[model samples]
Structure formats: structure tokens, C-alpha cells
Target: MTRRRLLGLAALVAALLVATAAVVTTRLVADRPAAPSAGPSTTPPASPTPAPTTASPTPPPGADLKGPLNLLLVGVDTRVSIPGWEPHADAVLLLHVPAGLDRAYLFSLPRDLVVDIPAYPKARYPGGRTKLTHAMSYGSRVPGDKANPSTAQGYELLRATVSRYTGLRIDAGAVITFGGFDKLVDTLGGVDLYVDQRVASRHRRPDGTMRTLSGGGYIGPQMVYEKGTRHLTGWQALDYARQRYTAGGDYTRQRHQQQLLRALARKIVDEGTARDPQRVEQVVAALGRTLVYAGGGRQLIDFAYALGGVPADRLTLVVLPGAGVSSGGAYRGEQLKPLGRDFLTALRGGRVDAFLTAHPSLRVKN
Candidate 1:
């Protein structure tokens, strides 16, 4: 799937993680199990319920979460209800919650960033250098079964690729589909976001239906998101986030994705949705229906308790500097600037706060 079509999925995983952590302490509970080994052949369970095993008891609400945790959040371009379709990572975000757990840093990795994908024997993929997004597609192939691809297997490979690139261990990860993302927004009664730029949807008409193709481009009255604060329904928000034709292109889209997530998280907390038992249940159920979670041996609920204290205001959005790479006059992919690499180095050393302080431009204004 093209990255443009599934851009909104990034916001879904981020919003879900924060929302789940914010409210799970109230009533969510499940048996904790031992952390699964990497590259397990078994498919991830459809729901977040951990396997029944006598491992460490689930942590209580407001428990102290370990510091310097890195989570890999990916938005895929597939539907949960459908099978036999290969999925690619449409949106890739890495969330870093400092040891204090008082705040979190979220950043996006351009889906088209150039990277070296390692060989995966499970899928018979002798990987090569390519766009980073292709790692998921290469790893998802079922060795003998061409009809169905394993998202879990694909996630493992993607995780490894990201870990290698960033030089950090992925403590946990989660995957959500585009369909699930729509449901999540609607479940919360939509979201209110500031339109940083006017964006015209390439896939949708003014009435929210798919745009028709003519002369190699969409033909219809475009759905336009005006520049201002507006309350948006699920479809509208998704369409807006999916647009990359704005001045900043994918970078603009990335900012919007982060804004959407913050808006969703703010709504959950500001509206008291997190504290309401019934509402929390509805949100949790919606997540259960949509999310494929891997907590690196930790339960989702544990993360909830650990990160419960992180409010929306404390979350910071970061944009890494990069430029387009081309070969033979053909667009190849993206490469990070030197400053971006330095930021990653700081992240590995737990000096992100200091680094951002020194280079204020890297921090996205709220």
C-alpha cells in the first residue's frame, strides 16, 4: 500500500497508547504472562489479552515504570477483518518516555527513508537496500502461503530494522490498521484539531466518497480542510491527515498526524472520558478490536499504569531534519541530515532534553 493512503494510522497507534495508559488503571485487568521471544512463529492474538501464565503479577495503577523506554508504533495498510492481503508499514513512529515518566517524546521516521533491510529466513527474503517501508512487506510474506501474510512476522522484521537504524532496543511495539483508526476516532465522538495548513484530499470528494480517477489524477470537487480550528468527524480527520500535497509535503502530513494524536489524547483527558467506566470500556473495546500489541514481555495494562502520569501537555512532538535523495534523476528515498543523526545519538545517550534545548527548532511548536 502507498504511504499516503495509510498516513492516519500513525495517529491511531499514538493516541491509543496514550489513551490506554491514561485509563486502564480504572478497570482494565488481565493475567500477565512471560515476554515472548522475538520472531515467534505464532500470530499475535487478535485482542490484547496476555496468555494465561504464572509470570509476574500485573502492576498496579500508578506503578513506577522503568525509564528510557522505546516503543515502536506502526500504522499498517491492511484491515483486521480481511485476510490474504500483504501489509506494509505506512507510518512509523518511535516514542521515547524518559525514566522519570513525567514526559514523553514522539518522533516520526519518514516511511520513504532509505535503509538496509536485513535478510529474513522465515520469509525467504534476502533483503537489500531500499525504502524503509518495504521492510514490512518483505518480512510479511508467508514462506509457502502466497495468499496470506503474517503481520506479526512483518512487525518483527520492521522492529529489527528500526532498532538497527536507531541503535536502541525496542521495549515494545503496537500495530493498527487504517480501518481501526477510523473506528477509534469515531468512538471518541471525533476530534478537534488545528489545521496548520489547508489540505485537499486526493482520495475523497467533498461529500466523503472516493474520488474518481481521470487523466491520471483524481477528478472531483476536493474535500478541503480549511486553515483553522475545527471539529472533524472520523472520515474528515483521516482524509485530512492522509493529504501530503501541502507545501511541506509528507513532513506536513507528519505534523498533522502528531497533532491529531495530541488532539485525541487531549479530548480523552479534558472530556473526562478516561475516568468514566462505561466510556473507558467502549474505548478499550474499540482498541481491542483494532490493535495488535507486542509489549516486549510486558502487558499493555502495565504500560498504562507506568505512563498514566504523562498528560497530553507533557508530550513533545519532534521533527527530524532530512532531505530527498535521488539517483540518475529518479527520486530514490530520504536521508536524514547530520543534525538528525546527532539527535539520535543524544536519544541513545538519554540526553534528548538537553539536545532539544540546544536546538529549539527541532521541537515542533504545540
Candidate 2:
């Protein structure tokens, strides 16, 4: 029998930790963040998602977060002060890392996931209770209307909820706001992706027009399709990843994002192996700048080491056991419900551990 795993709650529950560094990368130099705006360079446009941070990545020995670990990546929809487009999470993922790992398996969790928000502070939220989407909003949504803070707070809320429910102790937390999302995709020279369906064509168009592109086309505000795999720019990647309507809504979009991550992981691994240390560093730095993380270095390294411990064949995205949509209950943006039992079962039995044992563990010094 598989024992349920506890979602790591406390570790990631703290507020955001901002890593403000005048970092340099392939696109932008250390001293100048706006430098890349001048012209094109050898590096891809390095715009990262502005993730409000909480913790620095952790590095340790004999700690728990090794060998087949599962992580939940929260994409917060923050209202950016920038001109057009209201902020909303393009997607959310319940990503899993292997014990003794290197990479991670990502599973998209719809923001509108209909589940019990058990840990919601009753004193704060007197409106009874709500769906899981609030978990993501907790960081920014300030009950009435004071002012939204950062994505870091949202991850903390989610971490708490997941821990209260699943009982998993995660290593860290991070958020990729809409602004950060656009930048990161742009920085990647745009991520190559494909959409399986038709979706709404505008970011904030009052006119309800929907255009369907094939598979290979430059993405922007409309659905562009070409065939097979094609190159995408930042805006295009965001549009592609943000397309939930084509795949019947959030589920399809989430899956598409997962696919993109797989491709991205492959590219990154290849870059690292090719000994393009400089290039890899550039990418990592860009990622660090944009991604608001609870922790860094060791946390990511441990997850990587644990993930690397498992075989590719066994690297599977463990679906948190449960239903997605509630029977007759539906909320505006809410998508599915987390399977309480299934989530715990996977964790306690260490489904990831079995995978780690199947392969081999990688040792790293913190």
C-alpha cells in the first residue's frame, strides 16, 4: 500500500525574499538591466518573470528533499501597472522532483481547482470559504482592497494549504508573475511550443474575436499555428502557453505548458553538458532575476540531484489522486479539485523513492 506524502508546507510558508542583484547575463550586462533594450545581441532576449521571492534556494546533506521529490510551481496572475492587459496566471503546475534528482516532472494544476481551502484563516476571510484559486491569490488579493503585495506571499499560502492537505514538506517556493512570464519567454528567444486547439484571440480585446492558427506561426495576441515544432518569441510563447480555450480551457493549456517545460529541460541539460558554462550561467542568472523564489542553490540543486537519480523512463508526472471539477459546483476561474487521498498516498509511499531506487543517486556538496 502506498502511504500518502505530506506536502512541504512550513518550509515555503514565509513571505517573499527579494534577491535584488545587479546581475549580468547573455543578454543584459551586470550593471545595466535596460541595456538589452538598446539592440539585439548574441544571447536570447533575457526577460524573466518578476517572481516576488521568499526564501533562497537550500543546499544541505542527508536532508529529506532528495530522491524523487514533488514540487508545486505557482504561476500568480498579478496586475502589472504596465499599460495594456490585466494580470492573471496563465497557468499553475504541481511539479515533482525525484529524490537524488537533477530535473523535475511538471503537472499542471488549474488555478480554478475546486477544493477545500481548509487552512484559510477564518478571522481574515469571514466570507465562509472559497476555492483553491484563492490560495494563489492570497499573496496579492488583500480581502477588501488595500493593495496587492508580491507573489511570494501567494506561494506561502499555497505551501500552507498543500501541507495542511497533502502533508508534503517542499524545499522552497517561487512565483512567475505575468510580467516575469513574458520576459522569461522573451529571454528564451521564445520557447518553441504547439497548441492542440482553438482559443480566444485577444489579451484584453473588448471585441470577442477568436482566430485559430495552425502549428507554426509567430505568436503574439492571436492564436498562430504552423506544424511540428517551430521557433517562438516571448509574446508568442506566452500566447501559446496562455491558450486555455483551444484545449477546452485550463487543463489543455496546463498540459501544453508541461510539454514546453519538458522541451526546455532538455535544452538546458544539453547546454550544461555541452560545457557552455557561460551560456548556462547567463540563462540561470536571467531565470534567477525574474523568478521569485523562496530559496535557491541547494534547494534547486537537491531537487536536480534527486531528479537526476531517477531514470527517464520512470520520470512520470504523478497526478495528485482526485477529481478536477466538482459535480455541480463551478466557480468562474476555478478548474478542478485536488484528490486528498491520492496526493497523500503518493507522498507517504515515496513513489519518487521507488523511481530513485530504480536508477541511481547523484551526490553533490552543498
Candidate 3:
């Protein structure tokens, strides 16, 4: 069998375990997706005194895993093997499941969105106004140790920053490195995505090799993603999702990322990957390596079961209207338009469905 077919055979097996076992010993860590290649630089700030730990809000054990859940998923571009390197929140997404538990809303926050990141004592970062992506780097610093950054600590501060910005209590979350994301996609064979526009990769060549730099620009045949439904390998999918130089820029990239996510989820359900025990084993092993899941004091299995009812087709991709912000002709960052603020209010009030209904343009048609 082809690698894609072989890997896709085991997708979402954990969700299937919910029906067969009450207590699953298998542990699946939460994982974030891969971010764009040309994302912002992540340099750790100066470390001060070690700050106290600020734990995320966790529900009591055995608490009902009902509807209206918010999950924070982040993709970072950090290489653990490289010492003294910090991670940046390259891709930030919020998954909101309504009370019905039958559907979900996935929305992306602009990495360049300027926001007030509160002081994180753990990283000794005082509150400041900066791009959204910096929150991860500022929070990931290892206090008193500039060489090693803590991804977990970084996540805590990011959680705090996002919660403050959106006014949503994050029930659970996961952080995944770019390599891990690549591995996860490869493990599932590949993903089939609808390319809305043609995107020429800025990083990769036609043969899937890194482009050589020449004359302050990359010189080589580009890996082009044509507009249409295409079966993308792991590298292809990651490369496609990272393109932002196109007409729509980052917004277009965000839409592609969200679409890729839905496509992966849909493939698992549509292909009946859960029935084969061997495939399940393969998928679980891949997930174990790539994901660092935080269940908010609950077990991963609980989440699997609670979310089992949600079908991939019901996953709705939401677009928050925003534009680039500039001052004195120099690009500062990004700010959400008024409509985006209204959507956040709707999310906090648990009326996102109504909000989308009233503002249909915000909902991206599948």
C-alpha cells in the first residue's frame, strides 16, 4: 500500500477507543500544528528572577465534559535540539464547540495582532504592547538560564494572553513543534486539500529541497500549489499552508491552514481508520511523540469521548475581519476591525451561531 494509504488508515483511532474502553491507559499528548516557514523571529528576552508558576484553570476531575468548550491550539517553530533557541507562536487557533456538541467553530488569531501581553513572572516579562506572536517568546524564556527555553512555561503565558484578549476560559490546549506537526501529517499518510489559489512556495524548491539564497533572494524553481483539489504529502501540505506572499497575504494563509485541518479530520472519519487495530496502534504511537496535551486536569480520553460526537463535516471555519495596521508608513502590526470585536463578544456570550447568522461573511464556506 502507498504510504498515504497506510498512514491514513489509522487516523483518529483514539476517538474510537472511547466506545470500547472506559479507562484507556494509552496517553495522547496535545499537539499543535505546523506554522508558516517565514513566520516572525523568536528571540528570548533577558531573563530576570524566576517567577512563580501560573497554572491554567482546570476543571475539577470528573466534571461533566459538556458543550461550550474552548481549546487553544498553537504551532511553534522551535528546535529543541538547538540550544538557546526560543519558540514563537507561529499559528494560533481557537476551537470552540457549542453546547450542542455536534459541531465546532475554528478561528485563527493573527500572529501579528497587537495585544497587551500581561506580565509573566515565570519568564520575568513585564506587560507590554507587542505582536501576538511575541507572547510565546517572552513567556518561553528560562528564568536565569538563557540557553534553554521552556515550551510548557511559554504555553502558560500564551494561554494567559489569549484568555485576556478573547475573554474565553481555555479549557484545554496543546503545543506542537514544526517537526512534530510534519511527522503527524506524515503518519496519517497525507491530506487532501482544496487549494483556493495558486501559491508559490518561498522556501522550498520544485524537488522539495530548500531554495538557495542569491542576491538577497531565493533562487530556484519554486514548488507551486495549483488551484484545485489536490492530494498533498506532508511536506506539500506544510509548504502550502505557510505561503503568505500571495494576494490575500496572511489572511489567505490562515484560511488554507484552517481548511487543511478540516480536511485531515474529515479523512479520518470518511476512511474508517478506526476499525483496524494495527492502524490504531500506528496512529497512537505517532500522536504520543508529537503532542503535548493539557487536558485542564482531565484525562485525554475524557476529551476524546466528549468530542467523539462531533463530525468533521460540521467543523466550521470562521474568519475574523481585520487589516494591516501601519504608522508613519512603517508597518506596526495588525488590528481587528470592529466586526471582529463584535464576534469576540458573541463568542464570550455563547451566541456565535447567532453572530455568524447575522454576519454571514465571517463564516468561510466549506
lDDT of 1 by residue, 1-366 (tens): 211111112222233244444444344432334355667657767778876787885546336557777888887886445667778887888888878866788888888999989999999999899988899888989977977888888988999999999998888788777776776778889989888777888989888899999888888788988999999988898788778778887777777877777787677666766546787678668766456777767776556656655555677899998889999999999988999999999999989999999999998885
**For every candidate structure, what is the RMSD over all alpha carbons to the true structure, in angstroms?**
11.0, 13.9, 15.0
Compared with the true structure, the alpha-carbon lDDT of candidate 1 equals 0.75
lDDT of every predicted structure (CA atoms): 0.75, 0.45, 0.72
The 10-residue segment with the lowest total lDDT in model 3: 14-23
- How many residue pairs clash in all the candidates, one count each? 2, 75, 5
Best-to-worst order by TM-score is: 1, 3, 2
Candidate 2, residue 134: lDDT: 72
Cα error, candidate 3, residue 57 (Å): 29
lDDT of 2 by residue, 127-158 (tens): 22445667655534445544544455556666
Which 10-residue window of candidate 2 scores lowest in summed lDDT? 1-10
- Per-model TM-score, in order, reads 0.84, 0.61, 0.81
Against the correct fold, how does model 1 do in TM-score?
0.84
- What is the Cα-based TM-score of model 2? 0.61
